[model samples]
Target: MPNQTTFTIKLETELKDAFTKIAETEHCSVSQVMRDLMQQYIERHEYKHFLEDKVTSARASIANGQSIPHQDAKAIFKTRREKV
Candidate 1:
């Protein structure tokens, strides 16, 4: 956590207590659990958005008639795979 900054969030007392209890049970700080959860959430959404962007670009390419034939694409892929 070099170059770390403090972050604050509001939560209900009960929820905070529950989180604290779980953190103690696991012998880790609440911050660690929250960081892990946040990291997972960020990764999941980023991957989802990346796929969405790819689909949109593919759709645009098709709309503009800028795509190779399926067979041609497959042959290119096979050739490249063999070269590896």
Candidate 2:
């Protein structure tokens, strides 16, 4: 296991109680639940930015006339699949 660190977080009493119940139901500590949720939030935020960049790149490619028509692309892919 990696080194662990302890920190304090302030939560509303209702939220804390609800999360404690959730942790108990899941058979894990509140810290584990918070860690998992934080990790998921980070991953999803990163993926959102990744997709935004890809969309921007694709728009630039289209503007620069570097993309094929959708029908042409479909035909190319179909031919390749048939050859296999």
Candidate 3:
């Protein structure tokens, strides 16, 4: 299990009321809904970082002449698909 901590925030009453109503309709507690939203936000940010890192690595590899030509890669994949 992960260590749990409390987070505090202030928002308009109307926003809070709307969010609480949605959570209730979904059969979730307000805390659980907030936690789920936080987790989704974290995952989205982390995935963006992951994509940036991959793009950086790919650019470096291309600059170093370590990548195959596009047409060659496409041909290789075509052959692979035919084999499969």
Candidate 4:
């Protein structure tokens, strides 16, 4: 098994109660549900960063006159597709 650590958080009683009820309805432990939620949040955060980096790179390429025109790129892809 992987090494594990405990995390602590504070929330309102009503919020905790509602969350616990939902977790029970789903037949999942509170800890497991929290873990799943944390993983999803992390995945979304990382993907946001990935897209930001891609946009920055694309902008830099355009500024440096290194990007091909749309029609030329489309023609190139069309020829490649026909070769397959």
Q: What is the lDDT of residue 66 in candidate 3?
A: 99
lDDT of each: 0.96, 0.94, 0.96, 0.98
In candidate 1, position 14 carries an lDDT of: 98
**Candidate 3 global TM-score:** 0.91
Give the top-scoring candidate (TM-score): 3
Q: Extract clashing residue pairs from model 4.
A: none
The model with the greatest lDDT is 4
Superposed model 3: Cα runs more than 4 Å off:
none
Residue range 1-84, candidate 1, lDDT tens digits? 778778899999999999999999999998899999999999999999999999999999999999999999999999999999
Scanning candidate 3 in windows of ten residues, the lowest lDDT window is 1-10
Tell me how many clashing residue pairs each candidate has: 0, 0, 0, 0
lDDT of 3 by residue, 1-84 (tens): 399888899999999999999999999999999888999999999999999999999999999999999999999999999999
- Estimate, for each residue in 1-84, the C-alpha lDDT of model 2 and write its tens digit: 399888788889999998899899989998888798989999999999999999999999999999999999999999999999
lDDT of 4 by residue, 1-84 (tens): 299999999999999999999999999999999999999999999999999999999999999999999999999999999999
